[model samples]
Target: MLYRRFARPLLFRLDAERAHELAVSGLSRGWRALPGVPKEDPLLAQDLMGCHFPNPVGLAAGFDKYARAVAAWPRLGFGFAEIGTVTWRPQPGNPRPRVFRLPDDRALINRLGFNNHGAGRTAGRLARHRRRGHLGRVPLGINLGKSKRTPPEEAPSDYAESLKHLWPYADYVVVNVSSPNTPGLRDLQEESELAGILDALAAVNRARAEAAGSAPLPLLVKLAPDLEPAQLDAIVDLALARDLAGLIISNTTIAREDLASPASLAAEAGGLSGGPLRERSTQMLARARRRAGDGLVLIGVGGVFTADDAWAKIAAGASLVQVYTGFVYGGPGTARRIADGLAEYVHRAGLASISAAVGTAAEGGA
Candidate 1:
């Protein structure tokens, strides 16, 4: 109520990227003072990809690309937070005015181009958080991306370098070949290219596990929502063949149809996210779930704004769901509200646990 009625209106007045930076900086500086969300119910708890999530709702990757706010997530009520789309090399992203809001559509269009302080810097930050025990109570996943200057053929090595640098600090790593901002980044989603990258990361993961005497870190790929059915199936096949941990069902969509926002806003040249993406993302998730069955973990993202949306994703086959645009529009209380509502939904549906709800709708449809 406070965020929507008061904070949002005020924040909305600022430039989109500026408001984001301010919010993140404020949270990073004063997170300890913010009240934590209520304890999650056991029904909402989930064990996926070897990490125990206290709740299924998490903050998606783009919001904290630098991992600067690592400790603020759990306190803000998110079950987990995936940080970074950090590249192997530091690069200034696309020019300013890269982020735009579609308030009328409750959406966002951004072409920030994986702008971050780089993988090594992000790893160093996470290292400091680890030493201080400040990473909050939830799992932390690092989303890895190729350097903008790295050519398509060199993507595997680029991504591998990032994994090597950040391995120790990440609970899991998301291979991001899905963002629409970077030139030819989405092209890495092709079967041969994606398989090579996964293979490289898997080798590094094994070596790390042997050296550290810990379990091999989980590796999941984040896919673009724009993929064709055959492309998605091929990716799933490669994931299974390579023994990957899971997939983040989507990054953002390049499509521009069915938006309620102004024509000018819809004409922006970046991935579109929010209410308009809900149906497409959910449908893709359902398809992937049916193909992958119970063998893979799927984290649904895109257009999730409420418990009902999150629940729909879970039922479609996402063991976990993430929110980005929704968090921006809904504010700090969003995760808690969604988690609480999901627990109630589970009870009302007479499901034993959140896992019981996974892929139920997809299975019924099949």
Candidate 2:
């Protein structure tokens, strides 16, 4: 009640990226205050790709570019955390003023091109956290992207390099071929190119699993919401046929249609995320679910800002869900509120477990 009525409105007054950094810093300090927040009813824990999630709400990548907040998240009540869209080399990303607020649309647009302290620095941070035993029970997934200077044809090598170096620290690895801010990266989602990338990583993963005497890290493909239906169908078919672990139903979109932002702001060059993305992302989830069927897992993400939004994704076919903008907008209590709300919805709907709701509505749409 306090966040929705008070904090959110005040935070919305600031420029989006600055507001985001301020919130992350404040939440990192106040995470311990969460235990005293109301506990939502317990929902069944989930197992995805041989890993257990305490619950289904996950912090999407981009929130923690350098894996700086891993130890603070579990206390914030998220079931999992994914950090980075980190490149092989550290780059400043796009120019300042690259991130913009679309408050009237409750959305954000950013041309912040894959900026980070690079994969090596990120790995060192995680290694420090691991040695100190600081990463909480929540699992971690690392999102890998190609360096800006790497040519499109060399993407496989770029991603492979990331996987080779960062694999040991990540519970899962996401091939982020879809962020629109990166030039030519989305083109890699084309079947021939994507398969080559996935196939190369799969080989490395298989060997790594054998060498470690355990299962390979679950590999998920992050996609763009801007894809056409035929494109989406082909990608799902590829995932199923190739036996990839799963799909993250979307990344930030390039489209600006239907936004409530002023015409000038709407014309900004970048990807859009937050409230305006909810319905479109859910539609993509539904379409992908129909094509992928029960054979592949889906992690729904895009514009989720409330528990109802989260529930809508699960019904559409996401076995798990993630949030970036929602957390930015909804504040620290967002995850707890969504998880608690979904748990109530599950009980009221008479579903035995949250998994039972996955794609229940999608079957009809399918």
Candidate 3:
């Protein structure tokens, strides 16, 4: 109520990127003063990719692209934080006015193009956080992207280099081959290409584990929502074949269909996210879950604003749920509210645990 009635109106008035910067700055400096959410219900706890998450809600990649507010996520009630879509090298990203808001539709279009401070720098910052004991309790995953200047054929090596640099700091690593803003990035999602990338990262993960005498870093892939069913099926097959950790289910969509926002805003050239993406993303999640079965872990993202939306995804096969644009519009209480709502829904449904609800709707058992 406070966000919609007060904070949102003010933030919405500013330019989108500028408003984001202000929010990030404020959270980074004052996160400790923020109120904590209710104690996590054990029913909501999840053991995914060998890491124990206190809840199922996580902050998706792209929000904390540079790891500036690692500690703030748990305070704000996220079960985990996936920072970065960081590349092997830093780039300025798309030109100004790259991010725009469509308040009428409760969506955003961003072509920000992985504008982080590069892998090496990001690792340094995370190291500092670790040294200060400010890394928070929830697991931290790093979403790795290929450098823009790196050629398509070399994407495997490009991604491998980043994993090597960031391996120590990440609880898990996400291979992002689906950002629509980067030219030819999505091409890496092809069966053979994606296999190569995953293969390379798998080798790196194994070497790191052997050297450290620890478990290999769990590796997952993020896919684009605009893919055909055949494309998605192939990727799922590759994930299983390579023995990868799981899939992130989706990135933002390039499709602009059925939006309530004006054509001018919808016509913008970038990936579209938030409320308009809910149905499509959920459908994809259900399909992936059906294809991957019980073996693969899936994190459903796109257009998740409320507990009901999160529940829809969970029932459709998402083991975990993530939010990006929804967090932008829903304010600080969003995660807590959604987590609490999910726990209440689980209780009402007479389920043993939140995991019992996964895929029930998709499997026709709901």
Question: Backbone collision count in every prediction?
Answer: 0, 0, 0
Pairs in clash, predicted candidate 2:
none
Query: Model 3, residue 212: what's the lDDT?
Result: 98
lDDT at position 116, candidate 1: 92
Model 2 agreement with the true structure over 165-209: per-residue lDDT tens digits? 788888888999999888899999999999989988888888888
**Strongest candidate by lDDT:** 3
Q: CA shift at 67, candidate 2, in angstroms?
A: 0.6
Q: Runs in model 2 with CA error above 4 Å?
A: 4-10, 27-42, 364-366
* Residue-by-residue lDDT tens digits, candidate 1, 1-366: 999999999999999999999999999888888886568789999888888899999999999998888878998888999999889999899999999999888899999998998888888988899888876489899999999999999888899999889999888899999999999989999999898998888888999999999999999999999999899999998888888899998888999887888898889999988888888888889988999998899999989999999999999999999999999999998999899999999999998999999998996442
Q: Estimate every model's Cα lDDT from 0 to 1.
A: 0.91, 0.84, 0.91
- TM-score order of candidates, top first: 1, 3, 2
Give per-model CA RMSD.
1.2, 2.0, 1.5
TM per candidate: 0.98, 0.94, 0.98
lDDT, candidate 3, equals 0.91
Give the RMSD in angstroms, all C-alphas superposed, for model 3.
Answer: 1.5
